[model samples]
Target: MHKEQRDGRQEQLSDILGKLFTSRGWGRKNDRLRIESAWAEAAGPELLKDTQVLVIKRGVMEVAVRNAVLMSELAQFHKRKLLTKLRAAMPGVTLTDLKFRAAAW
Candidate 1:
């Protein structure tokens, strides 16, 4: 295939994938990945292992902690600071609160 033909086909495929993702609401999945990355940065490695960013809904982020003691400490002591870091890290996303819970898994 010619270079020009390959380029045209690549662009067409890109458009098709974009439309498919949009139609299936895959953008939210992308946003979730970004949020998880931001959470890792904001929470740091030591805490990252003990916590997981479950989901975000209506500006509230639900996080799963490894244990109830850690959850309590995070909810009482670190919640505000974590929220501040998260909001700063992802300015485009609305992160108003952090809810901590013991991990179901």
Candidate 2:
């Protein structure tokens, strides 16, 4: 293979990775823009500093929250908003639910 061919293939691979950076659902890289947008909107700046979203399996967001109180608060206060924002961000992202669990920090 020529250098140009190698470079072209590598560029293709990069594009694939860019797509995957959006979502790795079902162990397959698909529609990553949706996931990235969803994740970005789901958490507010204040909350995100303390929590981490580990994964989105199917339509559930596996979130690692720092404290039980905050988790409960978010459940009551932010769950709906987060899900709504997620939808706005991803459009078709599978994260219809947000599951907040105490994280091991």
Candidate 3:
């Protein structure tokens, strides 16, 4: 009822929500979504549609491409530019490299 009581309750609510997000892995999910969005923007819609963001182990991001030709192009030519764009887009994310694999899906 009092201002102090309301403020304390608000702080407690904030803490509870923060813990819930962490415990439920919502934070990681959000980070994944952000990463996907950044990848989509950087890779362009056409490339994104044929590729999937598999995982991020250490600082390397593993991407699955639909075909060997695209995979080769990405790995051989676009790798550097893509990495730079990804890093710039996701400044907080630790993205050291992009590894592309030919995968059927």
Candidate 4:
């Protein structure tokens, strides 16, 4: 295949994927996945070891931390920064709040 033909096929595939994602409402899910993958990067290695994102619903993210102390620390000191990082990483999704909780896992 020629270079021009390959470029056109690539563009067509991109458009088809975009439409499929939009039609199935996967865009939000993709954004959530991006945010989830970004958590460790945003929180740093120390915080990442203790924290896990449980769910994101209605613009609120519920995060589980290893202990109450860590939870409190995140709630008090890191929530806003994490939120900002999430917002920057996933601009198409609205992440309005973070809820931190102590986790058994």
Candidate 5:
């Protein structure tokens, strides 16, 4: 209701949520909505699928497309769109390069 009451409630909720997650061994980042975008394919096919993130610290992102032709296709056409999507998902998470390579091709 009051300003001070609202502030207190917010703090209390933050503390409670922190404690609950800590007790469960779920780190704070677990609940964080990670990067979800076409660019996320670099992290792995499944990492982004399950965790909603493309946690790559390196500028180069490794994605196994299995076909050099398709990799080139994506790099040329889809690269820009994928970058845009990743930027939209994680505004401050800077990613500059996409390294599309085949694992077996």
Candidate 6:
């Protein structure tokens, strides 16, 4: 009811939320989502349709392409450019490299 009590409760709630987020690895999952969104933006809708981010572990992003030709093109030509764009888009996150593979879906 009092202002002091309300402030204390707010702080407690904030602390609890922080702990929950950390305990559940929400931060990493959020960063991964950001990276995926950035990749979609950088790759464009067409390219994005044929490619999907498989995982990001230890600063490396593994991407799955629909076909070998697309994978080769992405790895040989677009990898560096995509990385640069991703870094620019997500400065808070570090993406060291991208690995592309031909995947069924």
Clashes of each: 0, 3, 0, 0, 0, 0
Residues 3-38 of candidate 5: C-alpha lDDT, one tens digit per residue: 245446434567777778899868745534353344
Q: Return the number of clashes found in candidate 5.
A: 0
**What would you estimate as the lDDT of candidate 1?**
0.88
lDDT score for candidate 5 against the true structure: 0.56
Model 5: worst 10 consecutive residues (lDDT sum): 46-55
Error of 2 at 103 (Å): 0.8
Assess the local accuracy of residue 47 in candidate 3 as a C-alpha lDDT between 0 and 100. Answer: 95
- The CA root-mean-square deviation of candidate 2, after full C-alpha superposition on the true structure, stands at 6.8
For model 6, the stretches where C-alpha displacement exceeds 4 angstroms are 1-13, 24-29
lDDT scores in order: 0.88, 0.72, 0.88, 0.82, 0.56, 0.85
* lDDT for residue 52 in candidate 2, whole number 0-100: 78
Compared with the true structure, what per-residue lDDT tens digits does model 2 show for residues 1-105?
Answer: 212354464345656665576465633434444465456656867887778777778788777889999999989998899888877777555656888899868
The order by descending lDDT is 3, 1, 6, 4, 2, 5
Query: Which stretches in model 5 have alpha-carbon errors above 4 Å?
Result: 1-33, 36-55
TM-score of 3: 0.83
RMSD of each: 5.4, 6.8, 3.8, 6.1, 7.3, 4.2
Q: Which candidate do you rate higher for lDDT, 2 or 3? A: 3
Candidate No. with top TM-score: 3
Candidate 5 residue pairs that clash: none
Candidate 3 lDDT over residue span 30-89, tens digit each = 989988888898899889899999888999999999999999999999999999999999
Please identify model 4 stretches exceeding 4 Å from their true place: 1-32
Q: For each candidate, what TM-score against the reference?
A: 0.77, 0.63, 0.83, 0.69, 0.48, 0.78
Query: How far does residue 33 in candidate 4 sit from its true spot (Å)?
Result: 3.3
lDDT (Cα) of model 6: 0.85
The 10-residue segment of model 6 with minimum total lDDT is 1-10
